[model samples]
Target: DTAVSQTPKYLVTQMGNDKSIKCEQNLGHDTMYWYKQDSKKFLKIMFSYNNKELIINETVPNRFSPKSPDKAHLNLHINSLELGDSAVYFCASSQASGGHYGYTFGSGTRLTVV
Candidate 1:
């Protein structure tokens, strides 16, 4: 069983189109994060929400947004998609306790713009 799951493992859209990726975690974690992996395989943190509160918001474009309906879910929405947006988006959940952190990651959603 997967601890974290993301829908539509693959996404393809045209430029200027809008798209959304959904993520959910079955583990009992309070913090969830969104990460983007570019073609070169460099991972960048996009957003992190903890216990229904916005904790960490990285330097991402305004076109990218994170929406969380609850603690276990965080979705990524992108507007006016461009060719440069093509990459793999990952959703992960982590737990922080006593200076120790444990993370569970989803399979990731691959977005391609053309």
Candidate 2:
């Protein structure tokens, strides 16, 4: 089984459309996160959730929302998607206490807004 997985690996939509991407991890981790990689390949964390509590990254836009329905799942919803929102969104999970350990990431969801 995949340690982490995301749905709809590719998404193409028009500007101003709304879309959601779903993610799940079977690593039994308590912390889950959403990251966005720009065309330049700069990766930044957009949101983090620990045991269903929200931990927003100040830099993220309000249009992006993350929901953790359970410990193993984190879903991202973007409203009024813009062309700037186009990027590869990655879902990752890691143990809450292991700072030295790296996160297990999903393949990524590529979203393109035309």
Candidate 3:
């Protein structure tokens, strides 16, 4: 079974459109995160959810929203998509034990905005 899984592995849309990507994990982790990999391959944390509570990165725009229905699932929604938002989004899960436990990341969802 996959430790973490993300749906719609690829997304292509117009700049003004809205889209959402779903993610689920069977690892029974307490914390889940959404990360974005920019064109330059810089990875940045966009949002994090611990037990369904949200902790968003200050640098992320309001247009991006992350919702976790439970500790096992986290979904990302982007509204009024822009070209700058095009990037590979990754979903990851980690236990409360910190970095020593390491994290499992799902195959990323590549979004392209025209």
- Candidate 2: segments with Cα more than 4 A from true spot: none
Model 3, span 26-102: residue lDDT tens: 98899999999998989888898898988656478889988888889999999999999999999999898556787
Whole-structure CA lDDT of model 3: 0.91
lDDT of 2 at 73: 96
Q: How many residue pairs clash in each candidate?
A: 0, 0, 0
Residue-wise C-alpha lDDT for candidate 2, range 1-114, written one tens digit per residue: 999999989999999999999999999999999999999999999899998988766487899988999999999999999999999999999898857788999999999999
lDDT of 3 at 52: 95
Model 2 lDDT, residue 45, Cα = 90
TM-score of 2: 0.95
lDDT of 1 by residue, 49-106 (tens): 9977788999999999999999989999999999999999999999855446766889
lDDT of 2 at 107: 98
